[model samples]
Target: MLWTHKILWIATLVSAFAFLGMTVDSLHRMSASTHADQLSAQVIEGKRVWQHYDCNDCHTILGIGAYYAPDVTKSYSQRGAPWLRKFLENPAAMYPSGRQMPNFHLSSAQIDSLVAYLGWVSRIDTNGWPPSPEGVTPAEDAQRAAGGELAGSKIYLAQGCNACHTIQGSGGTIAPDLTHVGSRRNKSWILAQINDPRRINAQSVMPSFAQLPESAKQQLVDYLDSLK
Candidate 1:
């Protein structure tokens, strides 16, 4: 009878250990899933801040939107932190010819968060939408293939520039109407202003076009010029 009691106790102990092991396994899986969800939420939140402020109106993400402004997907990698912070604080002082972005007066914390968000986006894969401009003798050839002056319009949509600058009586009203910018500014002037925007105005808010290729430059110029 004593031996029977010992066997029953041993069985109970084994069952308890098995249950504990299963519980631990389940808990680990749950924790892993939760972590994945949290990461996804972070990405979504960053995108939220972008859309909430209508960033798409001036900047282009991957290649799915308008291109009124610069392609910010690569800003984090190409631009330094100081330039990003300074520009975020005062864009108008940097580019004057066609100032757009308003003074959000964001705090340092906000700027940091925005920069973090931009950094996140800059890392996402884009399957090469804007092919490299290398090997092309004539920039115009690439421009024609990329849609010429229409390329600028496409960039405008992707960059969200239309949110501030107007074209053909459409888009936001905060900035000047660019429906006729092609006619007003010389091509060289536009190129110079875009390449190194700070040269135009120290207080200009327009973000500089850092990664725009020389070939795409001519296409954008042609597009802007065609606007007239």
Candidate 2:
């Protein structure tokens, strides 16, 4: 019985040591590849800005924070720097939707830092989390190729449609996915909704775009119609 007990203790010690060694090695490897290891001065400052502004109050980073806004882990990649800059500069104008984001009135320097920080976050390997597939349909691509000129695409971003509508698997979840809006609604109906969503749905929270120029409205409608 004494010998059996000794053998059992030896086995337990061996297993514990193996587990400890593996754990230490894994931690060491992860630490070497951590975001901190690649952070630049600008990115670090941008992180500070993010915290200073308490953006986490509304948005989430790396699966942390309130669900009031969309996850920003890959926002830099999803929304290009130009669009991000415009949105940050004037959230109200960009969204104009019912749930409009308040403008921070951030200066150019602050905007640069925030964008830089987000860019850094976008590069991190998140193990394929928050799956955001490029939802561009083939028809949409063909339309874009045939003299679409991206005018509508720009207008869509400028109007902050993504704030309430999901396109290509990104943006807020409050509204329906618009990846194939053209297939769901006719162009005239879409135009009507844009002009005044309340006219279509009495309970809709979408704000009116009646102030937009006639040509701009047409361009936006055309762009949306291209989404198959």
Candidate 3:
């Protein structure tokens, strides 16, 4: 009888634990039930807009989704809020040479929410990802600070330069390793190469920066110059 009673006690305890687990799950789900009640509404709404527009079908985020477009998760630190907003308004205006991302014609309210959402997404602790701060500065601002030209480390990503090049053993290997390039080339040499690639290497696969504004060129150059 004592053995049977102990067995019954064990069964009861198991049942109680199961009930507690269910209750905790219910509370979690309930807390996440409403969008407005979510931890970050801007992120939620931004996710909503992202899904509604099927952006993943074209672009990747957090290393998931399609590769046809640039990864946007790093845009905050790379492009900053202003450039991101402007790009959303008109992609062609920002990069005449690049493929177009259609203007969504989002309302002011929607834009605000989107910007907030992007900011929230940007803070999602990627464990010091992208390996760089991807400094915040306009192309013009970086150029003036660097004097002749900005290192343009960010330009490597912005111009899709990494699509063909590698950096610090990361990125594609199709082009070249650019991490220690600054040590190899002077500012004038770098400027001349970027401004007129054909002049240095007639058969070079890299694109010319002639079309890019001098300010943007300087910003990119500055970013590249900063790379180790």
TM-score per candidate, chains pooled: 0.41, 0.54, 0.46
- Ranking, TM-score, top scorer first: 2, 3, 1
lDDT for model 2: 0.81
- Which digits, one per residue and each the tens of the lDDT, describe model 1 over residues 105-152? 877766776776776666655556556655545666666656655566
lDDT of each: 0.69, 0.81, 0.68
User: C-alpha displacement of 116 in model 3, angstroms?
Assistant: 1.2
lDDT of 2 by residue, 126-226 (tens): 77888754687768778775766377776777566877898898876777898999899888998999888899679876766766678878888988898
The numbered model that scores best in TM-score is 2
Alpha-carbon runs more than 4 Å astray in model 3: 1-39, 128-228
Where is model 3 poorest over a 10-residue stretch in terms of lDDT?
A: 30-39
- Which window of 10 residues has the lowest lDDT sum in candidate 1? 33-42
Please identify which of the two predictions, 2 or 3, would achieve the higher TM-score against the true structure: 2
Write down the TM-score for model 3: 0.46
